[model samples]
Target: MVAKEGYRNGKRALVLLVMTALLLAACTGKEDQGKQEPEANKPKEPVELSIWQTVLNVNEEQFMQEYGSKIKEKFPEVTLRFIPYKGKGSAIQDLIAAGQMPDIIYASVGHIFFGVLDPQLQFDMTELIKKNQFDLTRFDPALIERQKQMANGGVYGLPTSMDTLVLYYNKDIFDKFGLSYPKNGMTWDETYELAKKLNRTEGGVAYRGFGMATGAMFTVNPLSLQSVDPSGDKARFTADEGFKKLFENFSRFYNIPGNEVTQQNITLAKQRELFDKDKVTAMFVNTGAFASSTYKDTMNWDVVSLPSFGETPGVGSQPIPTYFYIANPSKKKDKAFEVISYLTSNEFQQYAAKQGRFTSLNDRSIRSVYGDDIPYFKGKNVKSMFPVKNASPTPLTKYDSVALASLGTQFDQVLIGPKDINTALRDAVEDANKKIETEKGK
Candidate 1:
């Protein structure tokens, strides 16, 4: 009986020892599992990208509200710092000179020459685009083509929004004048006749019939005239016959006995104030219609497709697009590319379009949602925000802005001075070519 009891004790001890060994091995495996994860599964290192745009009067907070927050929600790893242009001290040149150039820059088609390309801030995004397999076809083909042309066949940027001309007419003015409201498909000639009827005085107020943005006729002409040729680095004011037609067609608007498009009224602000605040201007044509303008609360207005040129019956104003550019000085090129690329994604584009910034995408569904969320656009004819078709783009170069300025000088010369179209065009071509040569040097 004693020998059997001792053997039982030894068997029990061996079972207890085996259970302890197994428990130790299980704990060791758990400790090994608690180590750092594999590189592929690891959290991305944080990166902050700084942005600087030519958008003045808009503060950093406004930019973050409109744009930066959208980028942050998608990329928690990225922090965005918007550098605002406060004055000459914070200007693009000032920033670049201080060696404080930002990682990203923003500007529209017309300003890109001064804001990006001329400053040598443009970084060719081609390789980053190829590496990331970004599909440029997602954007409006016209926008992509313009972007390519803007860089002389190299893409330095991607579009964020689009703008085109529209005819903005105050409902009150038309009602008071007892004229039919402006219709979308009317020719410029037809619209001119309408403006003529409204050119009159009411209660001693001198209500002008029409006013225009100084750069509008020059930039968004239905005639597809570029102030300068893209590759030749030469001005086109006198060379292209379109200039004569363009000058003649609009020159008549100013000739009305009672309604003259004044020199100061040539400014967009002057036109907007005359149309919106003064409520005296009968017809005004420009981009950033009531929905995006400051006087949204002041005016009862609606839009039509920018009056068609009789020659190009269905053509609309040239598309003016805004782009996001990554700077050559960007240390975070890969991440910066990712940031701008993601902004073009359907999700972000849809969100922005709803807020009244027109989509850069080719998606009609997205385009249809423009201004859905803006208070000013409620019940407004937002469809008129688009023309029958965006006017086919003309090739552009860095010198076009200079030429456009020259054209503005000539526009005033013809309207306010004795210069005719031929004389004005000749002087403009000479002045632009000379200035362009200076631009080339600097």
Candidate 2:
């Protein structure tokens, strides 16, 4: 009986030992699992990003030659695919319908304001900007503010380059008239006085003092002048005194004696021909007009700061910036931001400056290198483009394009004396509201 009891005890002890060994193995396995490498430290697979631009043709060669290589060198695992499409039509919509949504988009401020690129589809970049520690101060303050305003206080995109309206004057015309060149930082009143002196009949040829492109007058106005209020769904120009003043300011150029007929019928092409081919216009108030082929080797021209209004003295026209926005549908947002941040970096901006493209960076060093590669701008007052303060961005609404179009048509009526300033503005407000209501119903 004692031997049997001892055998039972030995069997029980062996079972206990086996159970203890199993428990130890299980705990060791759990500790090994816990010690596994973190996912963040692991290498990520390569990614290909797509970028679409309406004006890619203009910059394609430069991008391939300069930016493309830089991107490859910096991100060897990433591939950039640039696709260009027609700017004016439904190409982008077709692409979206086909499920080929781009990871990034590049366009001008007009594109966003006119609803060509849907702002709602853009990723709010405020968080990305904060996370990346990207400095907004590096760019022009006005540009940053404009982007913020368009996004309704959210930064949806960033400007890559900025262009402002400047006074482009034909030196030969100024000399022939024996009038001094328009000075930088001149007020609209002062400029008009100068224009009066330049508008005259010289040997059966009409020498107009001043002319601006259609829709260019808005650039010189205060930021408060908006055509419509999308949020309120109302016209903003009817009761605004600024709109009246703006109309009067622009019409004075046409009201000059002997200039009435030409100003009433003049088109943009005619204005360019007057400045470039005919060389009769004393001054052309436009943005970057000197860079056009019209001024190439034809007329001796110079640029001065755009005329400022009494309301915002010393402030030039608002910056029309070219912006790049990342798509909300992009799966690779972080990577897209990385590329955008790099593209807007000082290094890239300097290269852009060298390529004669105006940079958005407010760096004096970058500005110093602008137009270095282009012989056309060698002796020009390229620096005149920088010194003045940018005009506040025009408050935009959903129906900005329609409203502006209506206003522009009425403005022409005012110039031709068919309608008074107040009547034209009232009619414009009515027309714009009607259009906006129709669009909303759709």
Candidate 1, after superposition: displacement of residue 226 in Å? 1.9
Return the TM-score for each candidate structure.
0.87, 0.83
Show the lowest summed lDDT stretch of 10 residues, model 2.
113-122
In candidate 2 the C-alpha lDDT for residue 368 amounts to: 90
- Residues 127-152, candidate 2: write the lDDT tens digits: 99999999999998888888887777
> RMSD to the native, candidate 1?
4.1
Taking all chains together, the TM-score of candidate 1 against the true structure is 0.87
Error of 1 at 69 (Å): 1.3
lDDT of 1 by residue, 1-442 (tens): 9999999999999999999999999988898887759886788899989898886777878888778888988888888888888777888898878878799988877778678877888888888888989899888778888877766677999998888877888888888878888887889899889888988887999888888775876787777787788668899888868898888888888888777655766566776788777889888887854457555656888877788878778687788888999999789988998888888889999998888888888888998888888887788777555776778788877677788998888888788767888999899899999999998898
CA lDDT, every prediction?
0.82, 0.77
Least accurate 10 contiguous residues by lDDT in model 1: 288-297
Q: How many backbone clashes does candidate 1 have?
A: 0
RMSD in Å for all candidates: 4.1, 6.8
Those runs of model 1 whose alpha carbons end farther than 4 Å from true positions after fitting are 1-42, 230-232, 262-269, 437-442
